[model samples]
Target: MNTIKVFIVRENDGSYSSYMDEQANLPYGLVGEGATVAEAMDEWNRAYNDMKNLFEEEGKEFVEAQFSFAYDVPSFLLYYAGKLTFAGLSKLTGISAAQLSQYANGYRNPSPKTTQKIQNALHAFGNELSQLQLV
Candidate 1:
């Protein structure tokens, strides 16, 4: 099992910052100054959701268990694991929901930075179904 790791940093403003080094590449939130841990957590959820939507938009497949190309995991494995809604993802990832919808529907694609950020958000639970033994 892959366990996700996270760290907290205190800011000069007396708020906090959360760095999620798991599969997700981008950090979760800055708790410094006026932000509370709750706020940071809210940010984390929002960011994570957006990345999940990114995967969905990309036409990726997701596998719920150990699967082979024959059995197959959905290319969007992380998306499933993350349990994100498209609107939610947009709110968190800062990408327009419409754009994300286009990506998921296969009308468009996300940029490199977007891809990296999405991966960062999924880093903790990166490989979901692949970890299964049957594949």
Candidate 2:
């Protein structure tokens, strides 16, 4: 499976758009846009397959590959806000709810330290959950 790194950008219209950061010699200008990150990812996958098929039909080398998506902070927040609210994330991250809300809304960017803090907290939580056993 070949993985493409996606860079998510928040648009002014409150939609998320993604582009392939490393095309690995593939054609240029592969982009996806939607109201949510998941939608944008689905769009990107469709576009990628369409392009790959076109190359194969044209007698060009088309390698079948599976893609895994990656999300940026704002996009992640927006996409998972239904599952985890800003307040919930703040509790886990030790970041203030107000700040988390700002980050979720694309009004502010988190510093590298803050980003690391959030990632670490999420990892810790995921580790704890992995150890759970049903009664």
Candidate 3:
């Protein structure tokens, strides 16, 4: 599966907007917006498929094939931060729960390094979970 980087941003009105980076070769100025990051991502997928189909109908090759998305930090946290307690996330990320809570609530933004750390920890946890087997 091809991986595409999608940068999702929260709008001032509390909705979310997303777009593919230039490297993805998607059309310029195409944006997807919705009430949540997931919804915005769904909108983006619909738009991408629509464009792909339109290009195909015109006998054009859409260079961008299937894609797996990579979401930005705020979008990722916004969607999932609520699912785990701040203490739980802190235990996994080595960040203080208060700081994690601040980041989750939009009271603070994590530095790039902190974001990377969090992402790496989450990926590691997911990998561990994937290794689970029923007794």
Candidate 4:
């Protein structure tokens, strides 16, 4: 099965949006909006299911693909804020807590390099946790 990339972003009003890029080259566009990430993702899945049903009813070909959801920098930071404090994340990523807070609040956007650094830090932390053994 093919994989479709879905991007999740936080809007200025503190709402969330999930959408597929135009470059997906699909027959139709998919989008969902909600007040939170989980709600947005649920709506996005509903959109896909609705489209699938429409194609089936019209006897059209429905593309079968999996979705890979990715969060933008601000969305990621905001979503994980509860589980990871800015001070903790600052230590993990070697970035200042204030700067991270600014990114989370949408006051500033991170450069591509800084974004990669954040991703790398999170992935490394995940890897370290995965290697843990509890007795």
Candidate 5:
């Protein structure tokens, strides 16, 4: 079954805001901000539909894999894959090793192009792993 979640963040300054969206399964969008939690959920639903339609039109899988944006899965996968070191990724991405470290630490999300490179890196690494397994 597909599921969605809402989390609340209270800024240190005393403002309260809420974010609502489906996580890994969201093909449409990750929505943030709602006057109330209900409002946010409503917005997320609409945005999700819009995203789904757009991706569908483009013939792309908007939600091909459940990407856990705030997680260590990416880091662990890259480390265990032995395909790209932080330094290697930095060179490949033209993003410094520090930036790559930040990415691995879940401190930031990569820009679209960088994210594409990360995905591409994972794909290539997986292909290599498969070949090695057969050997």
Candidate 6:
């Protein structure tokens, strides 16, 4: 199955958006925007299905793909805020909670180096969770 990469980003107005970059190279562009991540994703999925139906009606070949959603730093932070507190994330990434909060609130953008730091930390945490066993 073909996998399409979809990026979810937080807009300056605190809304969310889901979109495919040009690199996806699809015949049509797909985009969705909403006040939250879930809504944006739902709209994006609906857009895809609507496009597929249009293609069928036009007798055109529609490419079937599974979408892999990736989140921008702010979006990721905001989306997971309830589960992962800034203080906890700070410990994992060795960054201050205030700095993390600034990033999450879109008051500041992380440097590439800092972004990588966060990514590596999260991946390591996920690896740890993957190794867990039940009693």
Candidate 4 shows a clash count of 0
lDDT of 4 by residue, 1-135 (tens): 768899999888889999986678788779999999999999998999999999999999998878899999988998888999999999999999999999998789999999999999999999999999999
What is the alpha-carbon lDDT for the whole of candidate 3?
0.78
Clashes of 6: 0
> Which residue ranges in model 1 land beyond 4 Å of their true spot?
22-34, 61-135
The list of candidate 2 runs beyond 4 A from truth reads: 22-25, 63-66
Between 4 and 6, whose TM-score is larger? 4
- Per-prediction tally of clashes: 26, 0, 0, 0, 0, 0
- Model 3 poorest ten-residue lDDT run: 21-30
Leading candidate by TM-score: 4
Per-candidate TM equals 0.35, 0.79, 0.76, 0.92, 0.35, 0.86
Error of 3 at 67 (Å): 3.0
* lDDT at position 9, candidate 6: 93
Give lDDT tens digits, candidate 6, residues 1-135: 678899999887888999996688788888999998889999999999999999999999999888999887888999899999999999999999999999998899999999999999999999999999999
lDDT of 1 by residue, 60-114 (tens): 5422111011101122422232477667666556667677666654566677787
**Which residues of candidate 5, in runs, are more than 4 Å off?**
1-84, 91-94, 105-108, 133-135
Which ten-residue region of model 2 has the weakest summed lDDT? 20-29
Report the lDDT tens digits of candidate 3 across residue range 1-135: 446777887766879888777887544335788998778878988887788788899988676655556666655666776687778988999999888878766789899999999999999999999999989
Clash pairs detected, candidate 5: none
Residue-level lDDT tens digits of model 5 in 1-135? 454454454333433234444444453445544554345446655666787788899989766332222213343333333556778666554668787777655677677787777667766867876888442
Q: Positional deviation of 11 in candidate 2, in angstroms?
A: 3.0
Off by over 4 Å in 4: none
